[model samples]
Target: MTTELDLGSIRHAPKVLLHDHLDGGLRPDTVLELAERAGYRELPADEPVALADWFRTAAHSGSLERYLQPFAHTVAVMQTAEALHRVAYECVRDLAADAVVYAEVRFAPELHLAAGLTLPQVVEAVLAGFAAGQQDAAAAGTPIVVRTLVTAMRHAARSLDIAELAIDYRDRGVCGFDIAGAEAGHPPTRHLDAFEHIREYNGHSTIHAGEAFGLPSIHEALAFCGADRLGHGVRIVDDITEAADGGQRLGRLAALVRDNRVPLELCPSSNVQTGAVPSFAEHPFDLLARLRFRVTVNTDNRLMSDTSMSREMLRLVETFGYGWADLQRFTINAMKSAFYPFDQRLALIDDVIKPRYAVLIGG
Candidate 1:
């Protein structure tokens, strides 16, 4: 019989992460040092541990705006190419340490232009960092491959430019395009031009929708924008209902999402921090998973949420008593949903992910 999995075993399992932010996953000490180096004095705390605590406390304010406040400092320090490269490099190191075999780290290039670095320079620096980190990880006997997702801030107007940037860098390290920011007033429809541009190029796009807003935002993202995936599509749950006879009914949107296999990049901890759900137990992940809604767990903001893929999986294991099979399923879901090419994704699933899980499950 398979034994209960511990944090150690979970950490050893090969994992795939699809929706992590480069600006949101910096090491606390790295942020502090970078801020000091860049003369950015707006950070709430000078010390690493205190700064980390401040970020976690501030992000839990139950408002997406409040949760996003820390990015000002992170983005401030990340304006320089050196800072961007270091942050992306450390992100790979951290994820590899967590046994993440593959990840797609995203950040908006427009936000990193405060230092006057060209957008291509910013992308090049980050790609170089990921390459360096991957090489280092391989040398250290824990190999990891990281790709980039070029995100355009939803509140900003540079999305079409950013889409072109993603397309330009597709063969480099960039894998996909995304628009992430507050989803309330800034709908994905506002970036329809960018979405259309990506579609024209036959590129992949994941829209940040249905998190701060509800079904309407999700509707525009899927029905209008044709998102390949939904970033933090947690609020898609709002379209689902339970009947008096204890049967669950999915509204048109939810049914379409499920039937079409649109991946929901559900970041449970980040969702709770952003007030998307009351708490873990109240989260719709289990419901969506039970209904087979192409659910995949993620760490949207590692620093702010004080989380990693392993911790996210462990929390689910503790809360829902998930087994090795459940964990493997989530890993495979994320791997399958990755914007990576189909043949390579399948190769990772069969050659890397499955063998690791089989060893853990004693199969």
Candidate 2:
């Protein structure tokens, strides 16, 4: 008989993460040290544990605007090359330890420019750090492939520049381009030039839509901006309804999303913290999953949520009674949706994910 899956067993299974943010997952102690090194002392708490508590508590305010307030501290401390490098390195170390076999961590290059570093400089620093972290993780027997997704702030005008930057570094550790920030006023179509540029170059992009906004945001992201995926697409549920027969019915937009196999990067805990969903039970994740939407689990902000891949998966198992097979399906879904090259993604799925999951499922 299959053993009951818990946090320990979940961590042992290989996972793929596609929607994590680089600046949103800093270690508390790292934040403190970076702040001290940079001489930016605006932290709410001095102690590491207290600082961690502050971030978690602060992010639980149930407003997307309030949920984003804690990023100021993390961004303040991650200005210099050394600080960015250290945080990137530690991010890989932490994710590897959590048994995430592959991850695409994104950050806005424009946010790191306050330290006078150029966009390329910031991207280079993060890519170099990821490379070093991969080497270290491989040497330590917990091998992981960490790639970068260069993000442009949705409220900013430099999206085209960031898109070009992502394309320039595509052969490097950078895998794709993304746009993140508040989603209410700054619609994805506002960055039409950038999305067009990425498309012209045959590049990949994921837009932060359907999180803080409704169907229009998701519709524009898919139809106008041509996002390859939707980040925090919990609001896609808005376009779905229960029919009189008690079966879930998909609206026109939802039908298109499902028909196209568009992946929804759902972060359960972060969704609750941001008030995207009333709670985990109310989250559209299980509904989307049951309806066969290409739903993948993610920890949008590990630090803010006090979560890891194992913790996210374990929560699903606890709340939805997801077994090993379900977890494996999510992992494979993420792998399939990754912006990485097709050959590499296939190799990881065939050689790594499937075999490991087969063993875990006792096949």
Candidate 3:
């Protein structure tokens, strides 16, 4: 409530995160320790600080494929149930420390099967970790609610299986299903059965489109797959044009997206690291926000981008001069778009987000 709008001040403001990756947000020290305990010796750097630096540097290669290369080590160590639980617990603790009141963390269960853990075991382990973390955070007076999004690798054919697994644990802690990985060749259309299954069961889903791919991918996700949200839908900018009089124009697909209020889970720093945009200044987040798209800020990968919800909001505040009101709007947008039940989402917004922002904005 100081009107300073710095990192410390922003961290005190209640925030909602919609697109954090579980495996991608591990603590450097935890990764080193896990690797040592698991006898995994493929680490590029043995030291925690150096390993963290390596991830940031390597992710800056500006190619989506190259940016994803660092996940090999993270996923390698997370093969065991203990490793997965520890990582999940630490993810919630870190986000709670950053003042993220609600977050939907995603990870591919198929990736964690390397150590002979079944899909249900992987989901349960992460969910158990989240529950324990939430209890600890509440006891520490910085409460947070962390939900899981079961992800299917786009290149793999297990999307249907993953979708079922998500639905099976929907009542527990898993909130939704997702399809991720390189978006170029593996179109969301390829997983039509998985999306259709979720829809048949009345489940929620978000597709990883418009990041490394283009309009066709998005078109398929919405028109065909019926995605509830767009994961990194920054490339929707391509469908927006400028008129001769310096006005903005929205194409049919863009109009469809905007008119329907489809949420765009935008991760500014991760977008730049993955070469989705040249830099933060050129990101379409501001444009989409101004256009009234249901835009919500996120941290796609905390370890790779070294970002948190506060850092993401601070970037927008510094670049676009967003005030407390703006940040609150983004936070509310995320809460509304969350896969949580309507009543729970409304309760959090009314009781937590709005009240906290009122204090900051009024001060």
Candidate 4:
């Protein structure tokens, strides 16, 4: 093991998470309180520790319903505008605590329909929550910037409607659009109209591809429907070949990913829990990193996977023998792939991430 990984001062690290799910990251305390207030009795237990363990076990079951159980509890409580706002606020606070300087959290506004809030209302409330959360973090001296990505569920047939909602709110706070949920049969091409509309209206898109599926799913997401970034694209390693000695050839698809700089939001622990990767030791992260795959690390769902940005980084450091420089590359890759205009993205690189790493390296 390359034993130079020290994350003791983790809050000082510049972190970026792009694939976190809003519904999948509810605080256990929030869930218990929300369930009590909402008079919903579906919690596995009222205690936070037990509740968190229940979420991890249930979500890690490798079954569709088990994986989606937490959403029901989270969505049921998110009926009122206030609940939505509180959840959004806490999400940002949690990210800030994890030292995430920039994060793009995505959620399907359509799922928040139980409270009778319109799509735009849901978007607005979440943005208000993010602003509130950032303000609170600033007051606490841990400033962080968070943006929302409006996601449309693939199982639902309202991609076009969601696309319009995202476009309408783009200037407000919706940074990009995504399609997620049960990627087995639902390919990104299913939402071509949504993608095309997003493309026409000057919107950005990142598809949940190559997670529960394989290269064909990724190919379809990128080739058929132009996914600018990929969520959980760990399977692209399938297309790469290891030759005699140290030579390698990225099958056409992996080459496309590398050449185009399509970022892979690789959630190491979550990938193992979800069975996307066999194990952390065998995870393709270091391989992808060494090969320059525009790879970025993330906590796909903090509540479900029981992970923080620090924990994810620590797991990779201890497993992959990653040092500060390796992690610095991951952060830089995420900044490059963030859904922002060139100038703002450059500012994140020049101001936030680079300066922090320089201070760490004494460069």
Cα-lDDT of candidate 2? 0.93
Model 4, span 142-223: residue lDDT tens: 8887888889999889999999987888887888889988888787888999999999988888888888889998999899
Instruction: Give per-model TM-scores.
Output: 0.98, 0.99, 0.99, 0.96
* Per-residue accuracy of model 3 over 247-295 as CA lDDT, tens digit each: 8999999999999999999999999999999999999998999999999
lDDT of 3 at 300: 95
lDDT for 164 (candidate 1): 100
Point out where model 4 deviates above 4 Å: 1-4, 63-65
lDDT of 4: 0.86
**Could you arrange the candidates by lDDT from highest to lowest?**
3, 2, 1, 4
The residue ranges of model 1 lying beyond 4 angstroms of the native Cα positions read 1-3
Instruction: Please write out the lDDT profile of model 1 over residues 1-363, one tens digit for every residue.
Output: 565598877888999999999999999999989988988888999899999999899999897877898888889899887898899889999999999999999999999988899999999999999999999999998899899999999999999999999999999989989999888899889999999999999999998888889999999998889899999999988888998899899999899999999999999999999999999999999999999989998999999999999999999999888899999999999999999989999999999999888888884
TM-score of predicted structure 4: 0.96
Clashes of each: 0, 0, 0, 0
Task: List candidate 3 segments past 4 Å from native.
Answer: none
The residue-by-residue lDDT of candidate 2 on 236-262, one tens digit each, is 999999999999889999999999999
Q: Which residue pairs in candidate 1 collide?
A: none
lDDT of each: 0.92, 0.93, 0.94, 0.86
